[model samples]
Target: MLVLPAVVAALSIIFAVLTVGINFNLIHSIFIRKSLNKSKSLTLFYLRFVIDGFLGLQNAIMSTFILLKFLEVEYDEPVEFLFWISWTSMNCFNVRGILVIVISLDRTLAVFMPISYHNFRRRIRNFYLAIIPLSWPIVNNIVLWGVCQFRVNIPPGCVIFTCQMNQCYISYALSFEVVSHAIIALTSLILAVKLFIWNHCTQKGPKSRDLERANYLALIDTLIIIIFDIVPAGFTVKFPALSAQFGSLILVCKMSGYALESWLVRRALKRTNDIVSVSYANNSSMIKSTGQASSNHRHHRHINNHAWQ
Candidate 1:
């Protein structure tokens, strides 16, 4: 079971990076070309691409730090870069997690209450784009300030910080981190589920089915990320000795879940397409210009997004 988790994590990390790398290219193209008729869906997706890449890079940093220890070659006095990357990613992921839940809720709303969704329509997703990156600095300051104040010391090449055992209460940085992440994850999960059930009651049959699937997938993704990442990350920060091994296992689980999430999203969206296509076909409304629907750019986006992030 243990080895399986490690292997799954390594594979997931590779798969996640490969998928996100391709998506990074696509969003960059879309962002650069800047001509595609932008919809809220496209905007939210591109925004998520940015957030995922940021968090993915942070995962890389953390994985590298741990791997350095496993190889027994860490010869540094203080692994300071990790202190920042770890917490920054923590904050980034939580904030982004909230945003993902919000977007999924929006999609659910659009399906169930297309009329009512207009009220929640956002003019500037730009505000979110700016706010998420800005959150990293907040995480950074909090971590740095705590370290300076607490003076967590380890004399012999600290793989993880070794603070005074009974002084765990003094080390409140991690306590703060854990509480913040837990709150965000719990809140997002509750809202996502509530809106999804509301959707079940309100949507047309087929649209409801597709949204239900997406809603379910969204909740699953959120739960996995929380259980596998946030909870372990929290414990590891607070009690390194007790949590390190378990934390490593959790990291791997998180990476694998991320890879799986990509597939889930593609399938959910394809289901959405299926429901849309069936609705059109049943109406016998033959398109005058199938050409635009099958245009090269659209085809390219569809093909490329198969490795969706």
Candidate 2:
């Protein structure tokens, strides 16, 4: 029964590791290229990459523990510490869910107010604000963990093996998941609608091309999130049995979102490189033309002087 989840989790871990390497390269590419170094939006992408990496690592570890305990491969006695570790990891999804919200909100803001967005992007301090949402999942899960540990008195052996929780805790967990799903869906819908309207509007004179590209990327991200995270979460809440089945698949979806972000970054970098190449070519041609014109003028002046002499 658990074999699929185990294999999926193992694969998720490998994919996550590869994602981390890819994200590192993406960030490095931005810094190494002088043109990309000035881009504040690209700098902000580092947050998403790090959060995605953390989520992947956390999910992988959580799945490993679940597999080990289920097969009785080791840890016959469930250590209190290990149980808490698993519990903490389980909450990472929620944190990632909130981070998705943060990304959506920031992208939306950039679209709505490109001028102000540029001003905001200039400050390093403002970029740190995205990290604030991390607390939401962290605090929520800690309280839930407390409820299980103190209020419910979960048996030590069943801590890992059982999904049986007090109705209150289960209700809270499901409600939280539902709420997060709703938020992600609603925000994505809003952005998609706005983008559609903007596309139709004849006058888009004020909007910067970069903002347009960013919003388009956000729209794609929202679609991906809806497919992977939101839908799976909704299904899990409605059908508890599927949670066990789709456990590692959810982790894969999370990693997929990160994969998308890395792809967007690389695409943006390529576009920038193309623009720089074209600009450099234009400048080289202009300089050569200017030099030829100056030489022609000097030659003409010499000819006139020699004729007069």
Best by TM-score: 2
In model 2, which runs have C-alpha deviations exceeding 4 angstroms? 1-3, 32-38, 67-72, 75-92, 113-125, 145-170, 204-209, 242-247, 284-288, 291-309
Give the distance in Å from residue 131's predicted Cα in candidate 1 to where it truly belongs. 2.1
Tens digits of per-residue lDDT, candidate 1, 1-309, equal 344334444554575575466446545544685422233444555566676666666776566555555555547734555655655665665566556656555555554566656465555454664465446556545555554544434345333322221144335445654565565566556657667666676545544453455455556556666776676675655787665444355556566566566556555555555665687786655453555556867989988898684
Candidate 2: tens digits of C-alpha lDDT, residues 196-282: 777787545665556655566567666777777777766665887867764456666666666666677667657866886887899
C-alpha RMSD values across all candidates:
12.0, 4.3
In order, candidate lDDTs are 0.56, 0.64
In candidate 2, the residue pairs with backbone N, CA or C atoms under 3 Å apart (3 or more residues apart, or in different chains) clash, namely: none
Q: On a 0 to 100 scale, what is the lDDT of residue 26 in model 1?
A: 44
| CA displacement after TM-score superposition, residue 78 of candidate 1 (Å) | 8.2
